[model samples]
Target: MLNRYNPHAMHQGYYRYPTISGDTVAFVCEDDLWTVPVEGGIARRLTTSLSMVITPRYSPDGQWLAFVARDEGHPEVYVMPAEGGEPRRLTYQGAERVEVVGWTPDGDEVIYNSTAGRPPREVVLWRVSLEGGLPTQYPYGLANHISFGPNGAILLGRHTGDPARWKRYRGGTAGVFWIDRTGSGEFTRFQPTDGDLTAPMWIGERIYFVSDHEGIANIYSCLPDGADLQRHTHHEEYYVRYPSTDGKRIVYHAGADLYVLDLATGENRLIPVELRSPRTQAQRKFVETDKYLQEYTLHPQGHSLLLTVRGKPFTMGNWEGAVLQYGEPQGVRYRLSRFLNDGTRIITVSDASGEPCLELHTPDGVTRFEAFDIGHPYRLEVCPTADRIALSNHRFELHLFDIEQRTLQLVERSEYGMIEGFAWSPCGRWLAYSFAPNERTHIIKIYDTETGAIHPITQPEFRDVLPAWDPDGEMLYFISLRDYDPVPDNLQFEMAFPMGMRVMAVVLRKDIPNPLLPPPRPFEETK
Candidate 1:
């Protein structure tokens, strides 16, 4: 969450897609193109379009700027004066993504990659002349990151860089950097190691790129033949992202701050580009909150609804009355609330103190308690008796919290998986839940609160889940995938269960008879 909005609050703007042209550093922030001096100071917004501007690149002569912006649903290439002016749309590819790679070395055309005229996943490079007209594709079919060098030499990266999705990613899809020294349509793979290699920039004689080979992503440089391998910009926390060069300096962003790395002196510095515009989006505005409403339930007596919205947990009156939102700490998220047996008290989970805690909201005030200071309570249900509550966190543990005692009891720590689909018996003494023994099977388990004993009533061979108890507490009902009627796949050599689910029941006591067993006579004979 952002802090309270102050129009004059001059904090450094969090920007991305940083490109350098001489002493000017151009980047996109707040959905607008912004420029500031390389020495770092107050920034100025370049375009008033206020669209999704990204990947801004400066022309070789530093006279024109090319970028991608989306005014409608689709993104297209656009160009404008290097300083600031009205942007001119360059590409008319309707529903494809256009990412600005850079301008040509001669500054006559802009180079970009798009999914147009190809498969949705296959991206190829294209060039549009500055004088307008149709765009033409490069000779290569599929490539992502490309940087041109002097005398027709080029560096190609197989994939673009993204820190959020591909940080420390070591898989088959991980891109490899390649170089073409002759520009004769022959490209060979360089730096064949297994790391997320991307954002290749062929600066002068050495090729600079971002890689996580040292377990942390940083800017690294190596000879065109994949030697030397000098590591620059040792960022241990945030990965260096989208490093673009303007012949002398490399501009990229790590986390939210823009940084510049000089090629000759090896100097790295943060560009503190501050903003002065009113951040209306960051200001707290009133919302209907129905859009963010989640996990709602009726009141104990069907008078109102207890629900959690984007901000906090609140109650809405069914007939007439003002909506009551419980007083909570700002930025604390609450969920899964229910009216206690008292019909006036509410119990839910809150991350107020930075961890999950049981919060009780009553007519007087609010009180909170934690369960031995562990586990995040995402699933919660009030016992019909209302003295106890059942909690299940992401740690695969089930707990019982006593409202009066303010104590937590570790009822069961599931050894295999989560203890979902739990139900409190009408008597509130036996809690029935579906517990998994392995990844493939779930068995109904009953826990006796008074006796502290557990009993598994179902077999492991059958996959069962979602346990519900009868009102009289004599039987427990569940759904089981016991019937495996397999059907062979039409496309491949595999089988799938078309209809396997069946309603299952178990008699809780030895004196009760199995309802599923037959009477000893056929239906017609009995009739």
Candidate 2:
């Protein structure tokens, strides 16, 4: 029950990998992905991915299972069959999305990193061909944490020049190169007498890397000819991520959890894991659902609310700065708005010309009000008789603005394929939505503001849809995924899902009126 916006506090063990039968050692507890026996006791599961499989690795003859799935849409690179089915994609199209960072000792080939169209802040290594087609550019220069070495040699996190301006001689630099898989030049470079080294592991002649130099970042080893540079573990404020290995212990990520280290008794364990779950969080606090609320809006007497968030230095200003601020206090990206029909004002999204509109506040100031250019708009609704303002669009569409005739209207278009939540009924004329398509199905449908036609209802099972309608509009309250993914006698995520399958609720029309029937109240206010 510890979910004050949940920030870690629920982890068991397992996590650590290296099997392909080097005697066995793979771990990822609960939703499947295990493999112990490196001389220990029981532990076996090895393959599963319905919604989240991650960084698995194994294929130097362990048959095949080179991971990275994220359900689909961004993180790609699959191979499956280490006893699973239908997986094989191995990096496709790309334009800023294709992770699968390393594997090549005769696993046929695999090494990835992307930004598909080339520049979204650099990160471009590619070298596919596991008996398939396309993918072969490992030129070196704009790199990022790739790794290969059992003997094929190739390790990354590079950047020699032209990163729009480069800058770094002592403020946390990052170098660790050594190429030759066909992107030749014998590259060689490792200079980090201290600080700036990330995700580098090879283990044998040494090359364990992950450093903030000595001010934090920990786990270091080096010797790809850079010679004896040891410094293996002295944490300091926890930050390491991705430093893996299977040649007998070494795995990383220290605050997004997951940790291990035993390259011969320097012990460090904490494999009670999480691995990578901070898409964004800092002094965090979150909760929103006017159908996934984001751009803010809702007044005309439905109580109050107009939040925006990203204020007070929420960060951004070091692309070597020259007037490149994105969001935060000074940029005014904060929109903790509130309204219940003109008793006040408050609405914000900010950053107008660079797109992300709407602004209108009132402690007596801020009044830019334009609306939707989209960069993350999420569920906002206001329609009291079509005075309009509907929103939700990270490309699932929906739109519909008119805020007193300013003009706009896309009106709806998700097609049961990736629109996570939406609602509008209280007499504003029928809307209710929620979808997903394949994390085990999550439908919901229902549109029709005067016959634009939709109507789906129930027929979605397997958790997480989220909609909530009926303050007098027939009924709809969502969340589903009842049970499936709880195998953690010790952490696991080889292909995640099953760490407790959350999000549940269902009732198509028991006479409507269960807006989540009382079960969430108490955010501290007990006088």
Candidate 3:
């Protein structure tokens, strides 16, 4: 069976690192690539990696997508079609912490950042051809996220302070913004400030970057020569993170929502993204439960076993048979699962509706009974003949529950220790069980439903325990130490009754005569 969630449910998660091309805004979400319209409508997923995809950049022609995916156990460069398809790997150096900055203006190579040199301390920029080859290192020292100017210049952003990390960090190591007025390697700081500045981009003639000089991270722009510094956005609660532009409009994410800033009209509006992807990782994952398995109960028919795996109920079959796992809502813990008589419905004890209850499930739906007032149950057995169930709790109490009326009635309580075993009669009117009265001796007793009387079937002198009813309900079987065959020890002055245990049976009705006895008495020559 396919486990699927609500496809029509619309929710907004952390929409991060958006790059815009035309009216389509490609972004990173759920650790995969997704694209939504700038006008804000239903979003479509591009990749199914679920493997920490970051920094998606659109090609200049808006035909291909370049991003970084760690699906292969490490971050590497990968590119796919803008409309969603199988992504082809471009970089396979097995380098650590690779981030795709952006694509070259010509759309022939992808630019990214990684550790450089032998020891690899300072981060530098490298570009790899889209035709699959080794990446060539860019000459500028200490440059990560770089963008090409409209007039063939360089707008390189160095390390920037994260407002999400350090709120008001204005000290050194904040960030350094470098500008290359020409294509030459010469670089200089663009309007030095004490605040953290990152996410640099070059749209048209303005140099845009994120800064926190005003105590809150927002988008700011300046001319190429570091003149006319102006703040464009006024975000107060959350700092801006990873803003990208498509030479016309800027797409970025701040706080938990995505925002689009139009450089032409200077209008920034919040884009309500309708993100509803099949997040399989959140629903399915590997879990080691061999050491965590606490209990398992074999079904009465021997076709399956009721298992409490990590406090959840699952039914498993023998050898290549199917495994049926019951589903529960989020944050609900279910335990102690069993099948009712006839094996049509499953019964489970859960705390789902803010209180402890007994949940009954079948093909139709679920039915809950909140009057299940038992605590820490050790055994939950449904009567083999009726809708009633037998429950034994840690409080040394036995409870009788009605399935139809949703009522709980106390059957008995053990003052010395817990009730060892219980078996319901075929008529569902009698319950036979064994319990120790004082730690020294245990006896079997039967409770009659028609008459409110408890009858003891064995003497207290003999420790009779674990009474079970025959299929006919006319006889009872128990284990006792009545038969004695004492033997003296050779090395010590002690005698041990090694052959004392014997299976004992009691006939309830004297009318149950065995005709096969006395050798059937058929050879009397009555003919």
Candidate 4:
């Protein structure tokens, strides 16, 4: 029996998504991505400053690397010079919705699924050139994770035209199949096993897939001709993810740690390094530099957490920390008023006046402590230190307010587009803001308070938004959508990915306040 509420202690040894190649293996744990040598050496840190980086695929030539980065500005595919240079964005044409599923044999193009068209969306396969050219859509429909076999045929996660299967397929119980690049071939189902099959890896004539038929995810291998069934391992607790093979060993992530399985002997081995628990060890030492984990949780103190989750216009509201269902029929819109460090007084941007204004309130009375006639403070943001509040104004400029001094400081004066989200670094030294237009296309920018310099974190093409800072402020997580076509005839929203939500973490100067602010002050008796 456990006596303490230590969330970190219980989750110390879990690693995730391991990939092996010769002597090198890579995986992500607690949002940090790492790689190590297979000959029993220390693991090296790949990326720790971002909230989440997943679906990492090494180029066939082994000279380039690609992965999906869910940065605050967009969820797009990024490629770094294999030896390690700043990552270059590949797709910038769609919404904040896309996925990188397969790499072409030539290593010159990436195959991915995107939702570029309509609702009840279709996941269409699209290819982006590594050499930088316009993306071309494959004619197939309802497909995912496309892998080009040696013969140039594509292996895909089967898409059922019937709506019944769509509703029941969440725990990854989808069928794998083959299809041509053009929409002419019939959808032939691959495996009908009781377990859900996903992330299909094809090597020679043997088809390998990850399934959870025995109640735990594990790797299973079968011949493409549908013969010879083999169960590789007996490990029942850890989840087997992203099974990939170069016609040799099957590699994947076991509990965020990298692992490789020998096809000849059917044995498994763990990578030398383990990912630190996201709940504890906000930072950990790797072979050289330290890797950090990004965690997103509500600022437990209140006010700072607003839920615009349920609404008509969907304006913001304050998270008062307590669930009070009374008078105005509070909708999901919320904003950070004041924290306990100052008092229980909450501030919010509401449609009280003709134009939107900042309003302050307390539990005791409905009297207003402060009000500002700001236009459309859509994304209300507050800095925990220095008593500052910020909001996106009508002209697409970010307006900062000094709550105590009653002065406004223009932190970011931008006319680029509407601001989507903003977060302060843990140490309050910098601010990260994501912006896009009402129609969906934008940029995520990072500003240094000390140097007054602005760094654009994303490429100009993809629409990225929703930046959430990791607990340690080392990474920021946002959504990215790509593969856009502006032709009205081609614009059908047919590319909507089934996996819509992605989490990213950006490295920040430091970690911010959790259970934010000090405790609330005791109520004074009014005589």
Q: State TM-scores per candidate.
A: 0.81, 0.27, 0.53, 0.48
Model 4, range 27-79, lDDT digits (tens) per residue? Answer: 55556556666644555567654657766666776666677776656667777
For candidate 3, what's the RMSD?
Answer: 17.8
Candidate with the larger lDDT of 2 and 3:
3
Q: Model 4: which ten-residue window has the lowest total lDDT?
A: 288-297
Model 1: residue 248 alpha-carbon error in angstroms: 1.1
Segments of candidate 4 deviating more than 4 angstroms: 1-14, 30-32, 48-51, 118-121, 159-173, 179-187, 274-527
Strongest candidate by TM-score: 1
Question: In candidate 2, what are the lDDT values of residues 312-391, reduced to their tens digit?
Answer: 21211223323221234454454334342353544445554566776555556666655446446765665444555566
Rank the models by TM-score, top first. 1, 3, 4, 2
lDDT of 3 by residue, 235-334 (tens): 8788888888888878888776788888877888887778776666668777887877866767767787877777677788866677777758457778
lDDT of 1 by residue, 1-527 (tens): 11122323457567899999999999988888999998877888898775789999999999999999997568999999998988998889874767899888889999998989776777788899997889988877687778887778888777654644766787776767777887776888888345788888888888888888787778888878787888878777888887799889999988788888888888887776677767766888888767787778888788888877775777889988888778664778887788887688998877887787778888888887854654866577778875898888787888888889888898887778887678899888888888888887888898898999999888788778889998899999999988978899786689987788999888878998887786576557643
- Alpha-carbon lDDT, every model: 0.82, 0.57, 0.79, 0.60
Q: After superposition, how far is residue 148 of candidate 1 from its true place, in Å?
A: 2.5
